[model samples]
Target chain A: MAQTNLLSPPSTISPPTALQLSQKAPRIIANPPTSSLPWPLSLLFSAETPEAWVTHENALYACLRTHDDAAARQLLDRLSARFGESNERIITLRGIYEEATAKNNGELEVVFKKYEDILKQDPTNFGVRKRRVAVLKSLGRTSDAITALTMLVESSPTDLEAWAELGEMYAKVGEWARAIWCAEEVLLVMPNSWSAHAHLATLHYLSTQSSPHLAPLNLSLKNFARSIELNDSYLRGYYGLKLVCQKLIPLLSESSSVSKRNQDEDGPPPNLETVKKLEELATSKLAEIVRRYQPGTKEWQGYDGAEVIAARELLNRDANTER
Target chain B: MTLLQTAPKKQTLAQIRQQRSLVRGINLRTNANTLSPSSFQARKAYMVSAYQEGKFLADPEGRGKPRPNPMSDPAAMEGMMGMMKGNMAMMVPQTLIMGWINAFFSGFVIMKLPFPLTPQFKSMLQSGVGTRDLDVRWVSSLSWYFLTLFGLQPVYNFILGSNNAANQVTQQMGQVNPGAGLMGPEQDPDKLFLNEAENLEVLEHRWILDGVEDRLLARTAG
Candidate 1:
């Protein structure tokens, strides 16, 4: 796969990529923007492309992550100069800058207070509200974050990001049921997302560890199967599927002779033969993924390095047990 | 005629701005990363309950109040004025050209059609020329103007890229009739949501991964 570009922000930024992007900041910031004169006069000067602004914004983020506050501040000044300080997006960016530069909890709390004041002035500023929630989360106030997120979602039921964040917070606090509900809410909005299926499956698997219930395990198995079905190449889905099937196989074999009374409301448990086959399939798939996704390979460079290593270790452990 | 055509262009730009504000008000772009799915039967069940509870109409500001009509806003009125000014700008040059053509090129054949035409087209193709026996293939200057008026669409598209406002035919057809768009102000969003929910209810959920394992195994074996 081609390396990701810095002009458009990526969902997750690794430390090395952040460093690389921040190193380009001074060069990007050195170029002065085109003079924003009236239309005909503006045309006489060199025109600034929208991509330049996007690059400036992304460079600021990268600088913030790499702790290059000077470069970040310069980029921020340029942005505010162009768009004005009162622009809602610029306000959010400024809030993020303050949060990043805060040295202690007291300074962070002051930043949080600023967000609160911004929200009080314009309650409709969802960006500042989200920042406030983030500040709460960073302050180790999980319950308060959950409360704020719940209010956010109640007002905007279709806000899938808030729902996902709420689910993660619930999972953090071991509120498995609420986390599952939050995941289901996300599923309601986006019906074709394979990653959501894998996420819900992972939540179920985690819940199963705490409660040791056959119901969650079965749901986890079906969801993992559904996720892999949606996206055949999803490594996380395959890994979860293999792990769940391995756990289910032994349990199913042990309970083979037990007389059935009440059927599970979720679904019937997997058959022993099917579970064993799924385990074997998962094992083979994981082995293939690990082999094909070798380091420095051009074709399969998309898989995360850590995930491939984990899959290889799982395969090795399985071989050792079998031997 | 120009006013009638280009009015909708300005309206569309204003509509886009309004929609962007609405999207930003709910933080849609910043929170767009999550994904989800469910079986149709289950989704239908959820939608039904959700609709009954009025979840679709939930206000993001947490106030249970309906929003004002976007078309009636002052911004839309300003857009209407801007569109009028644009139409006026286009009309002056158009009128000047028409007068210039009438003064200099009336009653003259400007060009000929490549293919033969029936005598029925003689009046249309030789509009300004009064000669009754003139071949229908010989196009008058006025007729040529009309042809270019309708036919310069591809030329405009070539020079200005696809979505330029200079195309007259598209401008004529693309008039934004109030309450005619997908999310028009006059349409009740509650009804639209209910209709969509009903449609989703009947949708059959087919799992695409049904025989995926077999397919994967076959590919690997081969």
Candidate 2:
């Protein structure tokens, strides 16, 4: 959890302002407690690096993570002050603050009502609209959230973030086809995004898993390969390919035993030799990445934490079985 | 500088898109006689056009015709001097008054500056004033003139517009970087579009998604 990017290595005092140096003053660090400082006083003590306005959201999220309501409230207050109370961004941040700090569902519903009122007054407020979807999801109204997101995408189809969110929402409710469609729409907007290709592959894999009979694995494998081809540094694409190939090797070895085999007399599109080649390709690529970028190194640190761990585990499993 | 080397031209996003459509049209026309669905589908004209057009926008300055040197031409030099007159106007007035005031005042009043200066500066600044001793650390009115000359940037900016004459640093910088002015000149859009169109013919598209699904299932179910 990137609670706050402002936190530095402890010995390296970040900015080393007056408060951070003195022993007598209550200095703030990475994660401050809920009631550590009063809203007005906290501003003087806590120092986030002056980044672009968007990074303030990271700070706000960080405050929420630590359950530091006073700091979160102060941060939101600062944002609202900077970009007036009537600003769409301020309204969304306020909603997020309310949602985060709320003790019960009643409070959440109240926040939901606030969003609805804001949206009703000015419908083009997309920031508030997105926040409303989040609130709806939080309120356990998935269908409503889906409808809202669908409407959002229809109006602004090129909004890649909205498409990605819609994809996840669809996947959550077990609507694989629609999820795939969402992925496709995202691709339509940004065809060259390697992450999008990897994500589409994952959706295809999930689609196959959801079906009673096996869907074509070719699409999934091809997407994974395409993702890797587009971006050589794509760790997720390699990891997905490795996992798919591991599952695939067994299916190819025992194709007769599987009920839903391909009916083409061309006797499988890739054939057995090609599957082994891909399996080797994934394994070698993954091994090279794991070997080259050792854990805690800058290169390794660029990879996702879970993906790195998963890749390490996969390699270890292979090593153990070989032994 | 290398006469043997050839650099590709750079085109904008709009130029690239226009070239792609033109190439698509060319592909359709060239193979009009052999326009079977199967033969037509063999080459994805759109994809081939898209990834190639404007692949090299702003590649290198030297293509064929040598770039013009402003200093070599007398007319261009005079035009530049004319343009520079406004910037010099504010600086000239301030510099003249400040120098005169400094020369008049420092003849008698040998004032100590708020900050200390090195011994070397004392010779330069305290040239006409009193202090032949170690007390040469004192600053003359000449030092103040130098300080105000550079430091009055914010004051001038507040008085006149921001892009006004007080800031010589910014003005000199704008001079060094060509085409930094608001209404300097624009690149030829027609030339850029045509360059991009020429680049499109030799480009090829490799579709990674083609037969991908089939390959994945073939491996698994085999």
TM-score of chain B of each: 0.59, 0.44
Residue-level lDDT tens digits of model 2 in A272-292: 566677777778878877876
Predicted model with the maximum TM-score: 1
Clashing pairs in 2: A217-B217, A218-B212, A218-B213, A218-B216, A218-B217, A219-B213, A252-B222, B10-B57, B10-B58, B11-B57
lDDT of 2 by residue, B94-184 (tens): 7789778866776554567677777778766675566667465565676656666677777766444355544544656656332223112
DockQ, per model, reads 0.12, 0.06
The residue pairs in collision within model 1 are A190-B36, A191-B37
Q: Interface root-mean-square deviation for each candidate? A: 9.3, 12.2
Best by DockQ: 1
Candidate that scores best on lDDT: 1
Task: Supply the TM-score for candidate 2.
Answer: 0.52
TM-score of 1: 0.75
